[model samples]
Target: MTNEQVIRSFFETVRSGKDPDQAPHYMANEVLAHQINGENRVTVHRTPQNYADHVREMIDAFGTFQLTVEEVISQDPKVYVRWQQRGTHIGEYEGYAPTGKEIIELASAVYRLEECKIVEYWIQIDRLGILEQLKRNQM
Candidate 1:
């Protein structure tokens, strides 16, 4: 798939509040995404099912989070994405009750694709923004 197509599908899957299964057309069955930005951490999932819990966690916390792609520059198998994430805290998040706060964060993700399927992604987003909205000063 072209870089544009792959990125488009990512947003669609999350926005639809659906599982990766909904977009098998975009993955290699063993898709891997790395949390390199928001979490400032790196983890890899070998299979789509491997990320089921994380997916639920994300959709649950943000409660309608959307990754809006702003700029994308690709050079085969690798693409850098500049995006904004917007969502509302509507449920239990970080062991806290629904704060009913909406958060917007700027972020970037470097996607690694194999055979047109995104095998891995390195993402970064502003966690402090959400924390501030929750009225908890971040360290």
Candidate 2:
């Protein structure tokens, strides 16, 4: 599969709220993920198994979710994706208890692929907006 296709399938698997059965096919043995939220930033290097576990944790936190791909642009080893994610806050996130509020968040990611496997990625999402929604629901 192409890099774009791999990304689409990866998101689709996460959106389905099921354990990813094909994750190993799309992700490299070692992947570097850079995530930033508000003033906090984190970077994790994960094996395919570790990444799968991380994805599962996210799915569990978000509950049922949908990812709408707004754009996918690819040039050789680099691919960029812009997407919007909609879901209900049904599980704990970042030390905040679930508020059962619906959220719509936009995010973009850049991925570097080698031999159709994703090796590195940088992802940024609307973290502040999501937190605001959760805080509003708490009141």
Candidate 3:
């Protein structure tokens, strides 16, 4: 599969929390996942199983969600994807209890693929947007 196809499948299957076990099909055995929020950044080493587990946790919290791929661009081994996710807040997140409110999240990621498997990715999420939505309901 091409790098763009790999990313699209990963989002539709693994990231969508539909079939996270499919992570291994698209990700390397050991992958680097970088999370960036403004100037703060953290990198986590993720195995296929670890990545699957993380998706499962999100599914537990968000219930079923719709991930819409807005744009995709590829250059050699790197692919950039911009996406939007919509779901109901059915489970707790970041110390905020589930308010059953509908939530929409926007994020962008750049993934590096080697031999059709994703080896690394850097992702930035609109966390403040999520927090504000949660906070508004709390007041």
Instruction: Return the top candidate by TM-score.
Output: 3
Question: Compared to the true structure, candidate 1 yields what TM-score?
Answer: 0.76
Off by over 4 Å in 2: 14-19, 36-41
Model 1 lDDT at residue 57: 70
| TM-score winner, 2 or 3 | 3
List, residue by residue over 1-139, the lDDT tens digit for candidate 2: 8777877787677434455656787788888988965688889897778777776776677776777889989887888989887778788887778888787888898999998888998889988887888788778
Task: Give me the overall lDDT of model 3.
Answer: 0.91
- What tens digits encode model 1's per-residue C-alpha lDDT throughout 1-139? 5876776676667423566454455556776667765435667765655455566776787776776778888887788888887778777776667766776778787878777777777777676766676665222
Q: Between 1 and 2, whose lDDT is larger?
A: 2
Candidate 2 vs. true structure, TM-score: 0.87
Clashing pairs in 2: none
Native-referenced Cα lDDT, model 1 = 0.68
For model 2, give the 10-residue run with minimal summed lDDT: 13-22
> Which runs in model 1 stand beyond 4 Å of their true positions?
15-20, 37-40, 136-139
TM per candidate comes to 0.76, 0.87, 0.96
lDDT of 3 by residue, 86-128 (tens): 9888999989899888889999999999999999999999999
